[model samples]
Target: MPRSKRVTIADIARLAGVSPGAVSFALNGRPGVSEETRQRILAIADQHEWRPSSTARALVGSRAGVVGFAVNRPARTLGTEAFFTDLIAGVQSSLAQHRIGLQLVVVPDIGEEVDTYRRWRRSNQVDGVLMLDPRVDDPRPALLRSLALPGIVLGGSPSGPDDSATIWLDDAQAAHTVFDYLVGLGHRHIVYLSGPAEFEHVRLRSEVLAGLAERGVTGETIITDYSPTEVATTMRTLLSRQDRPTAIVFDNDVMAIAGLRVSQEMGVAVPTQLSLASFDDSVVTGLMHPSITCLTRDTFGFGEKAAEYLLDVIASEERLPDRTGPRPHLTVRESTAPPPA
Candidate 1:
């Protein structure tokens, strides 16, 4: 079959028997065109694979066609964590569909992250931003709002400004799931190895563990940098104690894997002597010895949804409601079992 000419809005209007203005209104999702006419115009546009050129979009005030994501984490830690890698792939995948690019930056700390956002806004380097690792009393939301820049927060509520929308998982419920599973396995002494304490999700998970005190199940939390070295040291330190926990939960798959290695070096057997579980499920967790039990969610899909929301916010002046992404489900594998007799 002969290929169709590069479809244009005028071609869509001519096919749908509507004015070009009507086609524009319908395609942009603005009011003015009747719903019936809007549907017809959309159908014609879809049939022809019509997409506006970046030049056309720029005439309508579109910026550099780029989005920003800044992370305040050490390069070593970021390099090892599969979650960031998978999440970035997903975000890029979604943005690429619309010809939008991502401007990712790694900063040394929160202060640097704030400065990066400021620079991006002032220089018009990015049309919008995607925020992660939300903290209690976070400054990013307010900073973005003050700059009048569009942004979407991932993994928690917007504490600083309502100008930004949020795409979050039910972290509290996920924490409960992990705790409940461990308790059911007859583990009383448990420990949670958490990422940075400032992260809202980490705090939420910590709260869930603390709440289990009423059930005669005690819990302790050790904050780490989510690096292999920190995780290994933390695991070794905890395991060397006389009252070492019979079960341990880690924040991410990398730390869980590191902890597993520490267990081997210290001559501690998994599942038999110590039950291990991690928060984020990844391929490494599944392939590792004793297959780590974990709370599994589509981190890649999470990134995609977050990027989609940010794009919508950037395109429209309307306020979108905060959305909850898919909940994390617990997947049991060989890493967790009942406490040793």
Candidate 2:
């Protein structure tokens, strides 16, 4: 038997009892088609294994049909961070639905990250870019706006030109929740193992911790690179102090797990001699010997929504309102408890 002909948009339209234009709008995720009709058209296309050809996509004036994601972190550290892994998975899943690709790049610092965006824009390598690790005086947003590039800020407020949108988490509220939880557990002497101070989220968390000083809770902030080695060293230094904290909170799972190891090596029992909590929840937190209490959020869903918003910016000229996703919630586990007597 001969192979069947490839399915076309017209065939999809005919089968769905819609026009070719309606099928185009549905498949492209445009606003013209109703949600029910869009689903039906998508179902038919999926059944037929139909995909838009690169030629067709380009003919519609779509440049490159790819999105860019650049990060300013050590490659090794990024490799161990499950948060980014899950986030990228969500981003790819959403972009795949639109038949778009993701261009991922890792830079050593914010300067290089800015340059990466400039290069992507100059070369037309991506339809838009996703910005992460936003800072107080971030220049990338302005640069992207000056270039008239469509971009989305992943975890910070929209500070760029009107063309960009921001999908941010409520970091301040999350910090408050964690702080209140720790204080309620009788942990008065606390130390926050944090990421670099330049990050906006880090600053916000630090501020929240500082506010505890007024309430008679002694809170100390120690900045680290979120690397296991740095975190271990910081943990050991703080633990060796004459007035060591009864509880320590780490900014990420990698550092939390390392702190746990350092505590064990130094003969400090977790949740007995010292309590530990992590900011970001990951697989290692739950599977470790003493499950870590940490702040958990839908990182995957965050990525998906960010990608969807960026795609919308690419598809239209209207400015969309900035979106805020669900805030991170504290998930209690074995790692956190009342300080030892």
| Per-residue lDDT over 110-215 for candidate 1, one digit per residue giving the tens place of the 0 to 100 score | 9889867765664456899998888877888888877778988897543333546788887888899999999999999999999989899999999999999999
Model 2, runs deviating above 4 Å? 1-60, 156-164
Best-matching candidate per lDDT: 1
Q: List the residue pairs that clash in candidate 1.
A: none
The candidate 1 region of ten consecutive residues with least summed lDDT is 155-164
Cα lDDT for residue 139, candidate 2: 79
Predicted structure 1: lDDT? 0.85
TM-score quality measure for candidate 2: 0.80
Q: Estimate TM-scores for all models.
A: 0.80, 0.80
Clashing residue pairs found in predicted model 2: none
User: What C-alpha lDDT, on a 0 to 100 scale, does residue 306 get in candidate 1?
Assistant: 87
